[model samples]
Target: MATLLFVLHVLGAVVWVGGMAFALLVLRPAAHEALEPPQRLALMDGVFRRFFRILWHVVPIVVLTGWAMWLGWYWGFGASIWHVHLMHLTGLVMAAIFGLVALGPGRAMRAALAAGDRPGAATALDRIRKGVSVNLALGLLTVAVAAWGRFGG
Candidate 1:
């Protein structure tokens, strides 16, 4: 059961963080070079729609499995090492940032694109990019904490 929970937790983080990394690093640059504003915005809209849908489910799984590991497997709260606490803190903050992007700029981008407001969509996408950038950095940091902090200590 613990193994299963750990696997799920890691998978959830991989999907979210990996997806962000690819979208930000690879996809964004390729799309910018290959497409114009209208096409680029449209592509981003579609990509975000699909990604956000997946994340809606993934986020909960990640949170639940993480909690199960910390509270159930690790002997519940305050009993684990500092790395675990850092992971929990960063994970929650990342989740909140995802929520902000999905609810705020995400919706705006969709609405703006639907109404043919390219500039508005661009603005929203820019905001989303910034949020994703921050989250990606945090995700990498959390990953490092989870990986090295265990053995380094």
Candidate 2:
């Protein structure tokens, strides 16, 4: 059970982080270079729709498995190591950012697109891009902390 949970947790993290990396590094650049605003916005809307859909599933697995491991098997918050606390803190922050993106800019983007408001959609997408960049940096930092913390102690 623990092994399965661990696998699921790791997979969830990989999918979420990897998807962000691909979007920020690859897709966003290609879209900007190859497409005009209307096409780019549409492409981004579709891309985020698919990616965020995957995230809805991944978030629960990651959060549940993480809490299970932390509170069920490993030491709870008070007894856990610094690394675990840091990971949890960062993870929660990432989740909150995701929520903001989904609920705030994401919704706005969709509504704007539906209303045929390209400028509005573009603004929303810009906000999402900034937010995702921050999340990606945090995610990478969390991974580094996880790896280094294991060996440090």
TM-score each candidate: 0.98, 0.97
Index of the highest-lDDT prediction: 1
Candidate 1 residue-wise lDDT, 8-98, digit = tens: 9999999999999999999999999999989999999999989999999999999999999999887889788888889999999999999
What is the lDDT of every predicted structure here? Answer: 0.95, 0.92
lDDT tens readout by residue for model 2, 1-153: 889888998899999999999999999999989998889999999999889988988988898899998996577888998888898999999999998998899999999999999999999999999999999999999888888987975
Q: Return the TM-score for candidate 1, rounded to 2 decimals.
A: 0.98
Model 1 residue 93 lDDT score: 99
Question: Cα deviation in Å at residue 19, candidate 2?
Answer: 0.5
**RMSD of each candidate relative to the true structure:** 0.7, 0.9
Model 1, stretches more than 4 Å misplaced? Answer: none
Worst 10 residues of 2 by lDDT: 69-78
Backbone clashes under 3 angstroms, per model: 0, 0
